[model samples]
Target: MSDDPKTLVSTDWLANHLKDPDLRVLDASWYLPDAGRDARAEYHAAHVPGARFFDIDEISDARSDLPHMAPPVEKFMSRMRRMGVGDGHQIVVYDGAGLLSAPRVWWLFKLMGHRDVAVLDGGFPKWQAEGRPTEDLAPVVKDRHLTVRYQNQLVRDVTQVSQASKLGTTQIVDARAAARFRGDAPEPREGLRAGHIPGARNVPFNTLLNTDQTMKSPDQLRTVFEGAGVDLSAPVITSCGSGITAAILGLALERIGHDRWSLYDGSWAEWGMFPTVPVATGDA
Candidate 1:
């Protein structure tokens, strides 16, 4: 494995660097409806000092019927600006459940042309459980000017993903749970198909993460992916429920020296809705 860029930092590293002037911390936590937890409410209760809540649902492609399609470049810029995230900021994102939603935010930053970002391993829960400093206080808001330089290469659309399935040029990896990928479980979103793409492989997002919410070692990540029949030499496009967990797959790919991977931003939310799109049921 190559010495990959430090796309991840430990909770200790974050605690030591919390007060760094250039570091901007974000609490990018969201939960499914069944979880019965409001991310905003939890953020208000207690969070890393100076951390801001990143709402996945709100900062999305508002016009698309698809759930959480990537927002337009202008909307993304506007949202980050309002959240005080500007150009040249070294962003560190963390979620309540460690590595979950944090990678999604990191992918967002990368898509917007910001690469100086990392996810906090072992996230807020780990920090709190370890008795690191936290507060119920929200940071004072300051407007920051973020330079908008969208990177189209890091993102793929429904059409591109569909074509990729036909051409078999890029390896399609679905990060959804195995049951969903195999059509054994109903989709979380009502009315969507339960199976995966015609030529996709299932690698559940949880497998990429440890019990503590940190990513596995590089060798382990490579093994996990290789077990799913994903060849790192080929181009990769990751998808999952609405594109959230798919970012985790992208992160894993990046960690394993495969930098030429992109995410299906609309993901199954769009593809599963199209009746004519091909879907494969049952495991390989």
Candidate 2:
């Protein structure tokens, strides 16, 4: 049987399917300053064979004052074209630190209306541990005219999110760790509040992933959501410290066949920066 698109994958699943013609692997690695690892450098040192690097920072909305906002349709199309990511390709993305940044790439593909994408389970660490093939050589770049079809419904602005919070029409899922979500942990960035949005449910992005960094099965993922008081049938919005990991939740929701979901672009970084925005902490 085919695997569920949402939750996670095993190394065995990936090893056996490596030669599939439609499969397109990507190294979507990004790291925080404290981690002290360069994703591009790591990708250059060694990567899965035929895997290309997906630079999240380089491909984002350059004009937006917010960090790493979604780029315009034209810029997205241009970038994908340079990367040779044509439509109809089955994309499988992975990060240096397991599932950290790959989901953002997965979410990016979906936001552009491409659904046949998945995050590599366990990420590069597991792939290397299994003695899988690796390459220092970069893949030859080929141009493809990847067109963009924007799906506005899959995104939420801060204003809309605030409105939703008051109406209780949408459930907000915060992917930050418990400490950050509760304001008990210091934020990585300076001068920002540490709590989460009012009424947001804490579902750390790592919980959705296995020890090896692969996603869990759809049934397992559904349980995780329900446990966090998230009703999949209802409207959903994902947020995180800076809007990155939240995409992981968005990817999970998409994988589980829940299409009525969006990523809060500004996320806590913006919301917390402003004292006027409603901030709530503790178990609510």
Top TM-score: which candidate number?
1
**96-115, model 2: which lDDT tens digit per residue?**
89888888888888788877
- Per-candidate total of colliding backbone pairs: 0, 7
Poorly placed runs, candidate 1 (over 4 Å): 1-6
TM-score of each: 0.96, 0.93
The 10-residue segment of model 1 with minimum total lDDT is 1-10
Q: Give the Å shift of residue 282 in candidate 2.
A: 1.7
lDDT of 2 at 132: 90
For candidate 1, what's the RMSD?
Answer: 1.7
lDDT for each of the candidates?
0.87, 0.84
Clashing pairs in 1: none
